[model samples]
Target chain A: MNETSAALEVRNIHKRFGGLEVLRGIDLRAGSGDVITLIGSSGSGKSTLLRCINLLEPPNEGEIIFDGESLALRRARDGTLVAADQQQITRLRAGVGFVFQNFNLWPHMTILENVIEAPRQVLGYSRDRAIADAESLLEKVGLADKRDGYPAFLSGGQQQRAAIARTLAMHPRVILFDEPTSALDPELVTEVLAVIRDLAEEGRTMLIVTHEMRFARDVSTQVVFLHEGRIEEQGPPSKVFESPESPRCREFLASHL
Target chain B: MRWSVILENLPQLLHGAWLTLELVLVSGVLGLAIAVPMAIVRCSRFASVRAFPWVYIYFFRGTPLLVQIFLVYYGLGQSPWVRDSLLWPVLSQAYWCAIIAFTFNTSAYTAEILRGAIQAVPEGEVEAARALGMGRVVTWRRIVLPRAFRIALPAYSNEVILMLKGSALASTITLLDLTGMARTIIARTYTPLEIFLAAGVLYVLITFLILGGFRLVERRLNRHLRPRTGH
Candidate 1:
């Protein structure tokens, strides 16, 4: 409760699918300008944790305090979970951006329209301001020239960068990246990492779940290694990578890193 | 094959074509109005919300269009409640009854086409919209609806052409559309083959015209799929 200064705090979050527990009592927090990279083997619940952060897959049991306000949730009659206060959830989501592995850009819209859409429709930005911000974000992501092109025409790397620009257009306080490079070709990884590296350099708060160890080691201020749906070890990247206390962490790092 | 009889009926046949065009046009526009919302509702999470449209699509699509026309025209007309209602004046006319029946029938098919298209849209884009804080309504308007409409275009065009042919059934109700005029001409001139052949050709011409219009729309909407000119 005293961690109100943090931009995001997840306390004892638990998620289950049928009888399988995907995430079990996980705890995490991110402060302003903190770049926390979560490294885990596939199915260690990394993506589910990221999704739970934004209530995209609302956790069965947890507290998600974003920007100091705890989320309000209710159990539906069918024993399903839903946000208790929809308006507040909307406001909370607008402040937190999520980047998907596949770059989920709207295929029907041009890059510029895709980038400007959330700002205009969700945040109520004026057309002029949304376009202006979108242009600058595109420039930052090195995609200014491709603003008018549809997603189908772009390279996988270019599409991922465009997705980043779209996320940046929201001016989010905290951004969640769910394995942003997993869907790209090996050669396309660096361009996206470069964009994210720049965001980290700008002192933006980010929570990244990635398999790219070198990039995580390079960009993360804090590194977390998850094993079997729990954080096995977490600290400065040097400690987690160089001298992991947990045997599971060392085993995971040996295999993936 | 009397040249004099054929020449004398040309003007009346053209007028019938005009009436048939009006019926198709009115029904098409009105049907779209019903189809869009009903399609969206069909994808709703609540069972009760989806039930009405499911039954509507089942009833209209399952039964014959001719039966639908008869039910609306004769069955509804025979009811005392309908005869005494505010809509009685409009319902009493065969023209309005045909319009009502055609609109209802076409709307069901269009709704099903659109519902399939809407569901076919990738779940990723919809999730992305929500991740960016878009409400359900905004997500549908900006993302779901437009993309689904593009996907539904070819199917919708077919539905309309079918409706254009189906509008011929209005003749059975005494609306005197293209087929009705052909029947009248056959009765007077006793040339069933010539009169029916002429009517079939007129229907083919209108179908081609509508197909051309839809092609233009498809081109405009799908310009995004075309490769960029310079790069």
Candidate 2:
């Protein structure tokens, strides 16, 4: 894809926690409408990379360019590349939606309220407008009837879907899923994946960190294999999954799949 | 003791009971106002912001309420600096001294209770709020504080009831609250058991009222979590 068409670009990102290096000089590019699946072992830093993209965990060193804007390198008063300010980082974050592995719905709020809160508070949308938008998103996720239900009252899969709707309500340009189905029971995984598949079909730009190899192969346009804090191999799903060029990718996929 | 004497002195006991209830109400409200903010500060990321309440809680929770009252009333009176200060006008009154002591003591315990509650708010919820692009202040106000208050409610109610009992300490500072009035009545009539029992019964009634109020608040907070029957 052309540089201008790419929704997110990560260049030489490095992240460390104390003595451990989690992400080591990772470079990636994802275009609009691309569904990229990041598959890796537990300590492979796929989730960390996704978090860095949203500034949830700021990278130790990196450049993240989103929508033609340099998110990592901020323009100083003298027009040089400095660190991004809090306001700039927050504006960048608002454009990206995130769904956690554990389905982090606000247990105290009703599903409808959870969906509407960000729009009303962050996006500065009118309460009425936020409610209307939340309702539509909830309907799309098949959760319109569960509007007043609390997260505790909903099943795990249902809560994850509601969380997706909550993210969608903000009208984010890209959505990141960090093992969104990993916390679900085996039987419930399909339901959550179904909602996600629908999102993929609708051409929502997505980066998913998941272990479900079959789903990743079927749904993703590109699949990246992260091994020991580096991208071992990445390509279109057919080439990566069916005919992986790297032995490390083959070993990783063999163990997981 | 004769039932008639008990019946006759009941009006005096009720008057004292009213004063006791007023003291508790005033102190409990003021104590919570101080405690909630103090708790937030104690949990703050900055060490400087967190230190003052830590010292306050350590001082009050470590010492007896009686000692605090004595220190506020007698100790402050003994200090030449305090005597010369503008604060002396407020400190000179026994009622103000009692209020100040009760406010300080209860606030320490309440702050600890609220800090535990705030900590009990799941890390996941805070992360979710942050991912939603909520600023720190908005996240705390809308999500963290409300939920933390709910989690802290039972403990806070217990503290309120404890403060109600603690207010009896105010009588030591020479405030003519319930226990003080009871002491006066005992001195005049030489009926200690009769007066003390009356005060005890009034306290029990107030405890019941606080328990009922807490139940109402708990129900309102948990309404969303309750299961629906018809659907």
Candidate 3:
């Protein structure tokens, strides 16, 4: 891909927790309208890699470039990459939205409040404008009637949809999902995946770490297989799932399927 | 047993009851202020910030409130430097000393209660706030502290009632609080049972008022969690 066409680029990213190396020398790139699905075993660093994209867990080494800006790279007085300040990283994070495994909705807030909070507080939208935008987004996610309810009162699927609405309200360029359906009951998983499918249809760029093999195969434009902190194989889902080139990918798919 | 005797001493008991209410009000407000910051420090990530309140809470909570009152009233009074210091003007007064002792004693317990509540706030909520790009101060104001205070409220109300009962210790410092007035009446009239029973009634009334106030606050704060009528 050309340098200007890439929406997100991870170059030689490494993350470690003391003795444990969670991600090792990982590199990836996604185009503006691409839906990249990462599939792997439980501790293969798929979620950790997604979190690193937002600087939620800063990588121990390497750089993450979003759009044309370097998210993990700091420019010096002479305009060179060094170490980014935490403040700049936080500002960069505003450009990316994340959906957690457990549908981390703010329980204290109404569904409407949860949707509008980031827009009003982070983006400095006025109350009237934020509410207007939030209502439309809630309607988009099919939660317009549940706007006044607390998250606890909602089903798992409903909460996940509300979470999607909350993230979309921020108008983030890239949305990340960390196993968005893992915590849901088997029956509820389809509804959450359906919302994700709708987001993909709208040409919203997405990076998802998930265990749902069929959802990945059906929805992903690209699929990455991660094993033991490394990308074992990756390509179009038709290629990766149907004809995984690597022995590790074959083993992983065999175990899961 | 005479109704006339009870009526004659009613004025003195009422005055003391007023003093007891004053003590509880002053100490409860001061205690909450001290507790919130103390609890924040107690749960801090840094070793020093965490250690400071750990010691403060341990000493204050480990010791009996009665002993703490005696130590402040008598032990500090025995110090020549304390007696001569500029602070002596305030500390020398029995009322101020009692307030200081009660405030400190209740603060230690309240801080622990608050710390548990603050810690009990789900990790997901904090993560959600951070993801919203809220600064530490705004997140604390909008999310953390409010929820923490809500969780701590029940325990705090119990502490307030305990502090009201604890105000009885103020009588030991020669303050003419409710229990002090009751003691005086008992000594003069030699009707310990009748006079103390009258004082007990006043305390029950005050406790009920406090309970009512907390119920109102709890209902308002938890309104969001209540089920909606139409939905």
Candidate 4:
């Protein structure tokens, strides 16, 4: 895939925690309507790579180009790559929404408040416009009726769904999911996955790090298999799942499948 | 031990109670103003910036409230520089001195309470705020502080009650608050038991009012936590 034309592209991203390198020279590209899944064993840096895209973890060395503009970076006095301008970072983050493994809904706020907070505060939308948009997004995630309810009052699946609606309220160009369903109960996982499936069907640009092999196979157009901080193999879902080139990817799929 | 002495001194006691209320109201407002900013400083990521509040909180929290009042009223009064300084007019009066002391003392405790509450805010929630692209000021104002203040409410109520009782120290600085009026009534009528009882009752009544006020705030903030009446 041509990097320039993709909605989001990562080139040779590297991240290190003291002596431990978490993401090693990772490269990824996603165009609009692309559903790319990152699957790997524990500590494979799938979540780290997703976080780096928004500079949440600020990759030690690499380039992230969102849409057509490359994220401007300057080496800090401490030798870390930080956004050259904070306003630029905030603007970039507004376009790249992140959904955490733990629902992370602000418990003090109602589901509707959680959804509308970013749009009103960060995006500076009027209250009426934000609430109007929030209701529609909540409707999309099947949580319109739960709008007035606090996150603590909701079930795990419902909270996750509300979280997705919150991310969508930002009108982001790319959505990153970090093990979205990993924290749910067995019976609840399907409910959240169904919402995600609906999002994929709607053709949202998404990057998902999930362990659910079947769901990944069904929803993702592209699949990347990571092993020990490096992408071992990547291709179309059928190619990566049915005929993984790397033995590591085959072993991971064998166990997970 | 005449019951009629209580009736005769009722107006005096009420006047003193009003001063006591004023002291608490003014100090509470001023203390909160000082504490909120200081608490934010206490929670600063940099150690150097945080150290200023650290020393302020430590100095006030370490000393006795009575001593703080004494120092502000008497100790500061003793200095020639303090006497000649532009602040002398305010510092010379027992009422202003008492307010200053109480404000500083309660502000220290309030700042500590707020710092703990701000720190207690969940990391995930903070991450969600940043992930949503909120600037630091907006995040603190809209997300961090609202939740932190809610978490700090119970502890803050305790501080308010303590300050209400602590205002009795104002009498030591010669500000005719409730306790001062009671002491004066006892001096004139020599009925310590009756006068002290009346003062205790007033303090108890004010404490209950503050408790009830905080309960209302907590209820409003936590309304979403309550179950909805309808499906």
Best by DockQ, which number?
Answer: 1
TM-score of candidate 2 against the unseen true structure: 0.94
TM-scores vs. true structure, each candidate: 0.96, 0.94, 0.91, 0.96
lDDT of 3 by residue, A61-158 (tens): 77888787876565444332343566665565677788999888877789998888888887889999999999999898889999999888899999
Q: Model 3: per-residue lDDT, tens digit, B1-231? A: 755666799999999999999999998899889988999899887897799899999999999888998888888999999999999998888898888899998999999999999999888887877775676777787888888988888988999999999899899889989999999988999988888888999999999999999999988786666466656
Compose the digit string of candidate 1's lDDT tens values, residues B1-231: 665665678899888999999999999999999999999999999999999999999999999999988988899988999999999999889999999999999999999999999999999999999999999999999999999999999999999999999999999999899999999889988998788878888899999999999999998897777565766
Better of 3 and 4 by DockQ: 4
Query: Model 1, which residues run further than 4 Å from truth?
Result: A78-80, B1-8, B226-231
Better of 2 and 4 by TM-score: 4
What local distance difference test score does each model get? 0.92, 0.87, 0.87, 0.92
- What is the Cα-based lDDT of residue A95 in candidate 4? 93
Fraction of the reference Cα-Cα interface contacts (below 8 Å) that each candidate reproduces: 0.72, 0.54, 0.44, 0.74
Superposition TM-score, candidate 3 onto the true structure: 0.91
RMSD to true structure for each model, in Å: 2.1, 3.3, 3.9, 2.2
Off by over 4 Å in 3: A72-84, A255-257, B1-8, B74-89, B224-231
Candidate order by DockQ, highest to lowest? 1, 4, 2, 3
What TM-score does the A-chain of candidate 2 achieve?
Answer: 0.94
User: What stretches of model 4 exceed 4 Å from their correct place?
Assistant: B1-4, B226-231
**Which DockQ-derived CAPRI band holds candidate 4?**
medium
